[model samples]
Structures are given as structure tokens and as C-alpha cells.
Target: MEVDEEENNDSISEEEEDSDREPNPKHCFITNLPDQLLLLILSFLPILDAINTSFLSTRWRYLWTLTTNLDFDQRLIVSPTEDFSKSRRLFASFVDRALLLHEGSEINRLRIWFNYDHELYESHLSSWIRFAILRNVKELDLQLEREWEDNDFYFWDMPFLFNPSVFIRDSVRVLKLCLPGLDPTPDMRFGSITTLHLKQIGLTERTIPDLLNFCPHLENLVLDHVGLYMAPLKIYSVKLKTLSIVNSIQMNGSVEIDAPNLLSFTCIRYLADDYLIKDVSSLVEAVIIFSLSNAFFQNWRKIVNALTHVRSLKVQSWWWMQHLQQTGEYSEEILPHKFRYLELETVLSKMELPGIARILRISPNLETMVLESDMVDQMVYMADNNASEESYTGDYLEKVFTGSPLYLKKLKITSFLATDNEIELVKYLLKYGVALEKIILVPYKTGLVSVSPEHLAERFQELQAFPRSSKDAEILLL
Candidate 1:
């Protein structure tokens, strides 16, 4: 006499149920799905909406709680009427409750991103970190942005002191912390950390030792806008394969790298007194970008000499090229004479011809050259207000123009404006490169903005008509 509960729940009277319900025939297709597949479908939905699935039927009542990933993004919770403070508290409460009831015993990944909050949400944030630690979370990402007010003053809603001891479980292999004011303890360690990223943090005397001891297996490291408080910063890691150091402020500390296995290194706008690079024989690629006027030639030379084994190099030294002229620091003898691929970012000007020619001369076996003018910087060039024309010295035409290049074959010129100076540079390379095989000219406005058909045609026509020494050479225009 008792109706089956499962059948009773599935059966709704046609008169009582809304017409919006799924077609009657298709009802059980979803409810009959396996639990594992159902959990995955819930994982893609927001936590709030995922939890609402329990209302569908008895089968999905606790399925959402079994999700191994937790992503709490504030943008999903904010309402038009709520202020920043109210929104912060509401998000905090929702997250705390979700974690407390979350059925997963071993969380695989946890991510939290929220709008800047003030003093009210610190404890909640701390609890979240503790929860991740207790659950042995594998991947954790915490992004805390600063909240700026009318006065342009901002406050970072983050715990300045993060004791690495809490994360000593060594379960976290990949971690990214982007807090502007994070300060670490000297004895902190991330035992199993392999890939680590720290942004807008302070590096003091204890910074290097604290990290090296804690993260022994660290291989990939990226430090961006790190404030250096010490004089000499020494980084020695034998297992490190990749490193990136970028600066938002002038670096007060000189860095010395002793990573023997390092394969790639990138430095941008970093000012150090002197760098001591040793045993980095595994290095194959390097990118160095500097505003030459603000850099010391001697300091720049020391950095270049260390890259003796690099096969691929890209340098952005627009202002530095002019610095060589103004400071009389020109040198054709410093760098090694071995390079397979060399890409340079500079404008084609008479003043830069000597430095460029000197560079080409050193690479006796250079095969490919890429010249990009989109990276042109006129900072130092525009500052030379008292400059009088020197009648365009540095006869690239008579010297590099007439000489026979042994290995130079392929050339690609991007952001080409078809200027007289640029054309002259092409002519110089064409006449000298007896082995030249191909030429590609991409107009300055190629992909950046719209270019008139006439202008684009002119850029291609000018370069194609330029004479080449190799009779079998082919030219392509883009």
C-alpha cells in the first residue's frame, strides 16, 4: 500500500509541477548518471549553485560536498547594493561554512581571490590558510590585492607574517602568493616546493637562506617587484632550471647567481652594482632589457661576459646604444664570437650603426638576424637637446657594406617603416651577406593598427627593389 519513495519523488503531478521542468521522458537520463560523473558536473558550477543541486533529488543531496577543488571568487558573490566591507564579511562567512562542511578529506586544489578588505576579514583569511594546511592541500593560490581610497593610499588585506612552519607538511608542490606586504620568517621552510612564485615581497638579509633551506627542491623561481633591503644578494641553487628577476624600483642589492643547471634567465630593469655569475654552463637562452642611459657600461659588460655559452639571445638596449656614443664606451671586442640566432630591438639610425655593425662583426658564424623597431625607445635620444648633426659618421656603407658575410643567410625585419636609414641598413646587409637567401619585411603598422593600402605597398616595394648580392635570394612581404 506504501508507494516507493524514490518513485514518489520522481513522479510529480502534471497539475502541480511547473511547465518549465525538463521533458518527462528525459527526466531520469540525468538522475540515472553515475555518482562520479555527477560530481564532475557539479565541480564546474559555482559552490553556491553546486550546493543547490541537493534540491533536485535525494541522490545529489551530499554529492557537491565531495568536490576536491574549492574556488571562492568574490566577483561571484558581490551584489550591486552591498558596500566593500559588507561584501567582505559575507564572503568570509560563506567560505568558512563551506569549508567546515566540505566532505572531501583530501583537498587537491584551493583558490581564493577577493576584493581588498580591511581589518575585519583578517581572521577569516587566516582560517582559510589554516584549513588548506590541515587538509594537506596540494596546490594553493592566494591573491590579495590592495584597496585604494580617495587619497591614493591603499591597504593590503593580508597577513604580513606567514610562518612557513604551518606549511612544513611539504604537501604543497606548486604555490603562488601575490601579497604586496608578505614578510617571511627566517626559519620558514617549504620542504617539497618545486615551483614557487613570490610577488611584491621584501627580501632582507635572511631572505636567501630562509628560502634555500626550506625549498631545497625549488627548480622554477620568479621574483617580480621584490624590494631588496640588503647590499649584496647571493642566490646559489644547483637544481634551479629557470629564473626571472624584474624590478619596479631601483634594486639596492647586487645579485650573484651560482646555478650550474640553470637553462634560462630573464632580467628586466634590474640595477645592481656588480653581478657574479659562475658555473652556469647549462644556460642556453637569455633575455636582457635595459635603458642604457641609466645603466653603467662596466656593469653591463660584466653581465654580458658571463653569457659565454648562450646560443639564443634577445637584447633591448635602445637607450644603451646611445649611451655607448655619449659615454665613449664603444667596444667591438668584449662579447664572444659565437651565436646562432640573435634578435635585436632598436631603431635604424646613423648613431646606432656603429654599435650594430660592431655586434654583427663579432658574430662570425651568425645565421639569422631579427630586427624589431616596435621596441624602439626615444627616451635618451629625445633628451639630447644640445645635439648638433655630426654629418652621419660610422660608414656602415663602406665597411660592413662591402665585406663578405660568411654565414649570414636569413633576415626578418619587423615594424619596418621603410625609412632611408632602415633601407640603407638592408642594403648594407644585402651587399655584405653573400649567402643571403631570404628577406621578410613586416611594416610597422602590420598588426598594431590599420595601415593604408598605398603605404603598405610602398613599404614592400622599397625593400623588394633593394639590390642583393645573392642572385638566388627570395623576398617575402607581409
Candidate 2:
């Protein structure tokens, strides 16, 4: 009878069979692959996609639960049109069930990004964090967005403090919390975390030091868009290596930093009336970019003095020259330490010529010089109608020109427009750069337009005709 059935099946044409028939597992190469390989392939997919593999077959149903990474987002699971209550219930249920079903003993990373009322899900979030801690999660990232009650904004403190188990974990090495209230208790200790990143949070003087004390082993700290309340914010840590304060709003006072082991300090648009830095002797590099001119005069000298040990400095202070002229702070006594490499982010106009020359005179050992044009600064400089349009006249050039040989070997001009001031700056450098060997000119580009080829050719020829202090000097226009 089996032979008769087999013979009948063989006799039927290929098109006569059901087209929607499920293929045999043995014939499906993907399904037949080793479970380890299949799980590895699933690891690259999003959490939802990885979980959807359970519907494929019984083998894959339990495999996804063993994955090391469980990244859950409420936005990815809940439909916007659904009822708020229903959506919240579904998301909560999904996270709870997923964590319960996870069979892995150790999770590499656990990320939960939820946008809901903290009061409603506080217990649930605490449970999830505890689960992560129990599983020895290495990288724990929690980004919770608090929902306002009546169109009013309020900071929701980290709710896991109720259960000290989550805060006392030693498995988490990298911790990232965004838009959460982070007020660590005096007894809490995050001793294992090496990198701590807090974004869009509010911090006070006490909380800042408390965080540093709690995370004793923290090496890299980043405060992005954080609002500081207390004046004269002081940050002191012995083990901190890299500190980045990006766009942090500080109140009326200054910032005092004392990190003896610090290696790199990056400040971008961080405004403070003054900076009092001490014992940063190990700092190798410092990048300070100020988009506002309010605090440059009061803060620049202190920052520069602290960065005397740095081999490289990248600064964007468009108003330094004007401030120096008004305050008479452009002498070697102000910036006594020299840097090996200097990168200035400013428009090569007469407004910045004196500052540039002063910096050059101080950094007599500078081997590389970069002149970069920051579009925002350029726009601000141009919009000020009261700003004097001082020409690059003989008197102006003569005042800045130090009759000394320059140690600059390589010069780079970015966003070059061949303006009269820009050309004069290039000529001034060429005239004094006795050790100059190479100069690279990058034309300014706007949308689809760039410096015309004919214009570039004319400028290149003109530059070649100018006098050179270095006989082996070469120019490149790109």
C-alpha cells in the first residue's frame, strides 16, 4: 500500500501538487542550520524581529529567549492609534513576559526605552532593573521619558532607589541614563561602573559630587545638555580620565575642576562666568569651543593656563581679538605656555588677525597650524552691524607682524574663500614661515557651488608669485 501511494505521488506532475505546501525541515537549509548559528543570525535583528522568529518553528521558539541582548522600546511595540490604557498594558505585559521568558544566564546588555508616566510604571521598572542586575547585565541603559500630568514639566527622579538592589549592582560596567532624575543617595555605591553618561538631566553642586563619590571607579563622565543649579560648580575626581561637558547650562557662577589624572577635557558651548582648574597636569588634549561671547574674556586665560601640559589645542574664540584689544590681555604674560599644534576655528578676517598673531607669537614651537572657518561664528560676526570692518591695512599688519622666524612646518586653511583678508593672512604666514614645507587650501563650498575653477587657478598663480621664506615650500589647492 505504501508503494502504491509513493508510485501515485511520483506519477503526479510537479504542477499538480499543492503550491502552498510547507517544505520539509530537511529540505530547508536555513531551518536545518545549527541552533547556535541561527541565534547568532537573530542577534543582529531588532528585539521585535528576533522575538517574531518563535512563530517559525518549535526549535526557534526557545532559541530567541537565550539571546544575550534584550533591547525593548515602547515605541516599537505600541501602536499610536491604540487606546492609551490598552497600549500601556500591552507594553508592560510584553516586557514582563519577555524578561520572564529569557533563559540566558548572563545578559550582555539590557536597554529599555519607555515613554510613560513614571508613577504608573515605577514598580514595573524597578522589577525589570532588578532582573537585569540578577542576570549580571554588563551594560544597563535605561531611557525613560516622563509624561506630564497637565502640560507642566517636572523632573521624575530615578525610581529604582526604592529597591537598593538595582543601585548596588556590580555587573553594570557602562551605565547610561537619559532624561531621568539622578540623585544618588549618600550610601549608594556604583563601584563597578567605568563610564557614566547622563543626558538631559538636572544637576546641582551637591548631586554632582555625590555622583562622583558614588561611582568611585568611574573613568569617563559625560554630561550632555545638563542644567546646573548652584553657582561655583566644583568637580573633583581622582580617577576620572576623560570629561566632556557638552552644552551644559551653568548659572551665574564659575566651574572649578580638579582632576589630577584627567587626560582629555572637551567643552562645547559650556558657558560659565569663570573657570578655576587645578592639578590637571596629565591632560594630553583640550578642545574648547564657545558659541557665545559672554564668558570668553573671563574664562579663556584660566582654561589656557590649566592646559599648559596639553600637546594639542583646538579653540574657536571669534571675539578673542576684540576682547584682548579692549582688555590689553594679549601679551605672553597671559598665555605663557606653548603648544606644539594649534587649530583656530575662526574667519580669517581683520577682527581675528591680532588674536591669531598673538597665539602664534606665544606658541613659538608650533609645528602644525590649522585655520578653520566656523559657519555659525562667521554668521554671528557678519550680523553685528556695530562691529567695525577693520581692513587688513599696512598699519594693522605691521602691528601684528613679529619680525621672527616661524617654526610652523605645515599649514592648512579650510573653507578658504580667497577674500582680501584671507589672502593677506596666507601671505603673512608665508613671509615668516621659514620652516614651512606644505600648505593645503580647501575651498569653501556652499550647497552645490564651490570656488570657480578659473578663480582658483588665478589665486593659485598669484600665491605662487608671492615671496616665500622657505625655499622648499609647496602649495596645494583642493
Candidate 3:
């Protein structure tokens, strides 16, 4: 009887243990996915992260090498406190190993970004370029930031020179380079390239014109922080549709553009340089941003007159308002062109009201208006002029828009602080904008101030109290 009881107790314990154990899960469905789909998933990840997926299982060990899009950024490998020389060596070694192990015959895109020292890594850089060209890369981006910024450039001594014949394969369609200098060879012709972005490169007067001849199919060109050899840089591309020049240096003389097929033009420069958009009859959009200077006001007028055909215009020039106040020359000349959209980035103060009024009068067909306040310059003019808190005199717009039709249907104000002056301006617009349908108010986003719930509620109530001239008008706070 005792032996029977011991056996039954042991059997009960075994049953309990069995019931507590969970069943094995089914095989992972993702592991069974097709190789092409897996490669596509890996392509979206950073190159380092993609490589890390190799450690997951034996099936993924070499799969990363088959990815067609590879971006090797040195910032991924080196920590901020790492030794510079050691980090460079580590980065270079990894790139070489990765490229050697890559199995793709044709790369869809390849980007390499690093702080380049010509004396130490010129050979490595040259080999990388050759490797991309040999692999039939469709889009290649090389952003080799030079270590030395003060050194003078010599054309023949340009770093990372490759065989001019290697690039004639007509495979690369988009090429972006941010090198100290570019090697211009007579035989260099990119027949398949459609878009080219060159940044921080030194170009001479003859370099660009000569380079354009090489890229027969190029349609988009961007020059950023590019220092020119002399003044009067002439760009005459027949097939080019978009052109942008930002933060360019040494272009003191006029930049004459004659791209007949151009559709969009953007110029953001600090210097008070002049530009002539000749033969660009197809231009429909223009963005011009310049710093305040005595010579910029005249250039602003010329650029606006030249862009008469543009239906959309966005300009940021605080000097225009300041200059107008000092001179008090309110010309009543209406532009021959009519703009459908106008965006102004300036300080919305008492002194700038007339300037804003002038723009509204000129744009008779304007349907949309966007006012973006430059917060940095917002207080400069106000304090300098010793302006009062109530800047809007209620009749400023009416006086300026007299006889000029107010066709504005939509309005947007960004960097709104909901101050007394700003509230007055909103009130004035609401009272006068008879055809207004909606108004958007976007609070300033400097990341320094946070609005309390109470403050937000108060602001909402205040906006609701303002009477609107248009019964259909809606006020939205964003």
C-alpha cells in the first residue's frame, strides 16, 4: 500500500510539470521571404546597420554584400572622442573590406562621405572612384570634405584624379560631388548624366562653361558655397530646367543666365551681387533671399521686374523695408506682371507695414499670401526705430490698398508670438480682407519657449473675439 501511494504522488508531479511547459512556435515567416525582397528591406537601412544584419544567422552572413545601394559614411564608425588618425584608418579599412566583399555587378547608388586628407588617402580615394565606375554605378555621390580650408587651390594638383576615359561609359545619371576642386579634362563627357550638384568646389570662369559642354543631357545644376575665380559668371544651358546658386563667393559682378528652358531659379547669397536672368522666358518660380545691404534694394527691383512672368514669388529681404523708411520714396508704379502667390520673410512691424502694403498693391491677382517673420531681425528694427506697442494704425492697409483690388483668399502667418502688435495686425487683416476665406497662424518654433495650457486657451479666446469681414472666413492656430 505504501509503495502504491509513492508511485501515484510521483506521477502527479510529472503531470503538473508537463502542463506548465509551452509549445514550440512556428518557423519565422520572414526567414522564408525572397532574397530580392530581403535586399530591398536592407537597402533602406544605413550601411552599418545593414552589415549588422549579417550576424543574425548564417543565411544572412553574406546577404548584405548583395545590396545595390551602399552609403559609407565615416560618421557612422568614429565616435566623437576617438583618436582622429586611428578612426581614419579604421574607416578606410572597413570601406576597403566591404567593397572587396560586395557581390553586386551593378550598383544602383553609392555614396561616400569622409573628411579627406589628400596626402594620406589620395590613393584610397582614387581607387574608390575607379571601383564605382567599374561597377556601373547609376548614381554616385562623393562628399570628400577637405581637412585644410586655408590652403590655396592648384588646378593640376587636384585630389582624387581618375582616368577621364573611365567615366565615358554613360552609366552614371546623377553625380553629386563636394570636393575642394574638380579635375576638368578635355575628354570628360557625361552623356547620361541628367542631374549634377557641386558644392564647396572652386570653379573658374572657364571651368563651368567647359564642364557644361561635357554634360550634354544635364537638366538640373546646383552650386553651393562655390568660390568663383572672378566676377561675371555666365551660365548658358539650353536644356537646363532648374538652377540654384546659394552662398556663392567672389561672384561680385552680375551672373548672366540665358537658360531658355529653365523653369525654376533660386538664389540665396549674402553679397549684394547683381544677376541678369536673360532669355529665361520659361521661368515660373523664383526664390530670392539676400542679406541687408545698400546695393540690394536696387537689385531686388531688377530681379522682381525680370521675374514678371513668374506666378509664384518668395523673397526675404529686411533691407527693403528699412531702406524704404529711411528714403520715404513710396512709388505708385504697378508691375506689369500679376502674381498668384507671394511669400515674404521679414519683420512684421510698423516700419514694414508700408512695404507689405506695396507688395499687396502690385500683386492684383494674388490669391495666397504667406508672411514668415525672421525672429532674429524682428526686434532689431523695432528697437532701432523706438516703435510703440500698437504698430498697426487700423488704416495702414486701407491707405496702401486704395484703388488696388484686394483679391487675397488665403493668408498664412508663421513665427507668430501672439504679441500685442501681432494681434493688432491680425485684427486689421480680418477687418479689411473681404474676400478672405481662411487664415492660418503658426506660432514661432524656436524650441526655447513652451506655451502653457492657460496661455493657449487665452490666445484661442482672443482670436475668436476678432470680427472677420468675410462670413466664410475661418481662423486656424497651428
Candidate 4:
């Protein structure tokens, strides 16, 4: 009995000893991951986040140094209380340090954003450009936000300008600059840049021609809120494929876009249209945004005339119908054209359906139609005030849908206030939409109580019981 008891005691001691032994290290195989796989994983992380991973373990400390893409954003480093000058200096030092730590390594991309004082801006700009050129950088994006004083004070001595023509190296293939104001000096050149984006820059006729001359091999160009000083500005680019211009003010100067190889074009609030629409056979898509002004309407017509071969057309405007009515060009004159997709927004019920119908008539091949607005209450109120005018419910829907082309397969109504008339409109579409594939109803704040899919299904079934011919329609409520 004593021997058996001793044996049991020995077994328990051995079990406890085994339990006390440590398991294999959790990340024993992490170090074995291939360097290429690790680098690829780190590439997706933002530069700061990737740097922070260095402290996770000793192996990760030097791993970040191997990353070829370095992105430094000063907004991340600046605090409200930090002196702007000191903050700029510290940021510059950090960037220099990071570069030194990764010396002799090739950098794929470099992005820096800073708001600097006038004294530091030029030197820091030179350093960044020099570093990018030395590393044979493929992409360089520098955004300099000028610090503004109180509402009355000016921001800087000179509107912080960096002439890409003079500062950029031939090795850079992609370059983006967003400055408050820039006057490209005559000596500036960007001969080797393939892609370029200029934002909020003052580009006159002479300056634009000079800039274009520098980028002989440029392919893609984006100009946003850029001022054109030259009237009748003629742009001639042979290698350019894509052109995007947004919120640009025209100098009553005619602007021409003459890129033969240009495949895609987008213009928003650009006044002059001389260059784009003139015999652009290769254009596949054209998007135009107009303001509710007489000048824009005249330009809109010219733009429409220019887009003879456009496969996709999107027009967005506030109070478009009122503008058209004010111009006295009714829907019967405009609704015979064809487009693949159509999106229109207006103050609902205030605009005439015939005018909407006129716009729709032009898009015979339109497969999808999206009607968005926040004016249901205004429509209801207007109908109440003018009882003689038809309500914007069943009558309006019947008129528009009945006249609309059957090619429209999808209809999306967003930010809609569902009223009795509006529900009847949806039912009418479901009943008459013979080629319709889907109908989506999105509720806004007002209108009928909560909506659901079951309610939509029941409504659809009730409409079908009366035997309208739209056999394959699907109704969705959200």
C-alpha cells in the first residue's frame, strides 16, 4: 500500500512538471516570412503606421527602413499650439532623417504636405525636389497650404509658387502640385512628366501654352479651379489621352481642347468649350455640369452639339428646368437625342414633366435613370397653393412614365418623400414598366411613415392584380 501511494505521488509530480514547461514561442515562424512578402504587406500601410510597427519587435525595427515608398504628411505632426515655424522645421528634419536612415535605397514614391512660413518654404521645396530627383522617384506629390492669419491679414509675401518646369527632374513620371497661387516662370520645364495635376493655380494663356510646351510627352492632365488668363486659349497636345477640368473660370477667352487621342473628357463649370467638342471622334464619355444661368445654358447647348458620338452623358444642375423655361426652349425641342444613362435633379413639381420628358427623349438607349431631389414638401405646398395645376402624384407620374422610352431598365428615386401620389407613381411604373428590371424607393425624412420590403411586395402584388403588362419588374423599398 505504501509503494502504490508513492507511485501515485510520483505520477502527480511528473504531470505538474510537464504543465509548467513553456509552449513554443507564439511567433517562432514570423522571422521566417520572406522579405518580399513582408515588404508587400507593409506597403499597403500608411507610412506612419508602418513606422509604428517597428516597435512591435526587434525584427520589425529595421524592416520599415527597407520600404521604398515614403509618405510624410505634416498635418499628422502639427498641433494647434505648436509654432508653425518650429513645426515645419521639425517635419523637414524628420523627413531628412528618414531619408538618411534609408540611404542608397531607391524610393518609389514621396508625398509631403506642409504649411510653411515664407522663409522656410523655398529651402524646404528645394530639398524635397532634390531628394526626389536623387532617388529617381517615380511619383512626387507636394501640397503646400499657405497659413492664413485672421480674416483681414494676408497669408504670405508671395503666393507660394513652385515652377515645375524649373524644379522637376526628367526622371519624374508623375507629378501633382496643389498650391494657392502659382505663376509658372518662363524658364520652367516639365519635359519628362507623363501625368500632371494642378489645383487652384493661376494659368493664363501664355502660361498654359508654356506649361504645355514643357510637357511634350504628357498624357494625363487635371486642372481644378484654375484660372485661365488667356481668352480663346488653344490647347494642343498629341499624346494626351485623358483631360479633366473642374470649377474653372473662363476669361471670356475661348478655350480649345485639341487632343486627337483623348479618350475621356470631364468638365464641370468650365465656360469655354472650343477645344473639346470640335471633332472629338475618340471620346467615349462626356460629363458636363451647368449652373442655372443664361450663359451656362448657351454653353450647354454648344457642349451638346459637340458631343455627337458620346456613349455616356451625365448632366447635373440645380434648377435646370427653370433655366430652360426661362430660356423659352421647351421639352419638345430637346427630347429626341439618345444616351446610355441619364441623371437629372430639380425642384420637384415646380418643373414641367414635358421638359423632363424632352430631356429623356434624347436618351433612347438610356438603360438607367436616377431622379434625386429634396423638394417633395415644396412640391406639395406649391400644389396646395395652385390647386388649378395638377398635383405631382398620379397625374405627373402617368404623364412622364407613359411618354418615357421603354429602354430604361432601372429607375432609382433617392431622397424621396413617399406621398399617396408618389406611391401611385411607383405603382404606375411597376404596372407599365414592361422592360423595367428594378425599381428602388429610398425614403427621405418626411412623407409616409416607415417603409419596408414586405410593404413594397404587397403594393406590387396589388398593382399586378389589376393586370398591367410589366411582367418582370422588381420593386425594392428602403
- Among all candidates shown, the one with the greatest TM-score: 3
TM-score of 2: 0.76
Worst 10 residues of 2 by lDDT: 1-10
For model 1, residues 1-478, the per-residue Cα lDDT tens digits are 1222332233322232332344344557987889888878877776766765665655656677898778877667545367766667666766777787787777777888776453666677778888998888888878765564565322222346444455566789878777665656644678788887876666766676568777889998888766665456778999899888876333466778899999988887676777778778899888776655544666666777788788878775454455565656545446645777878777666656656666776787778888877332543444464333342365533554455464578888887766676777777777677788887888766454555768767756776787777886777777
Worst 10 residues of 4 by lDDT: 1-10
Decoy 3 TM-score against native: 0.85
Clashes of 3: 0
Residues 390-416 of candidate 4 have per-residue lDDT tens digits of 433355445555654355688777765
Task: Give the best candidate by lDDT.
Answer: 2
lDDT agreement of model 1 with the native: 0.68
Give the clashing residue pairs of candidate 2, or none.
Answer: none
Native-to-model Cα distance after best TM-score fit, residue 470 in candidate 3, in Å: 2.5
Candidate 3 C-alpha lDDT tens digits along 149-222: 46553322365543445566589999988877566678778989999898877777687787789999889999
In terms of lDDT, model 4 sits at 0.63
The regions of model 3 sitting more than 4 angstroms off are: 1-29, 148-166, 270-273, 317-319, 326-337, 377-398, 401-405, 448-453
All predictions: root-mean-square deviation over Cα? 7.5, 8.8, 10.8, 11.4
Q: TM-scores, in order shown? A: 0.76, 0.76, 0.85, 0.77
Q: What does the lDDT read for residue 168 in candidate 2?
A: 77
Task: Point out the worst 10-residue segment of candidate 3 by lDDT.
Answer: 1-10
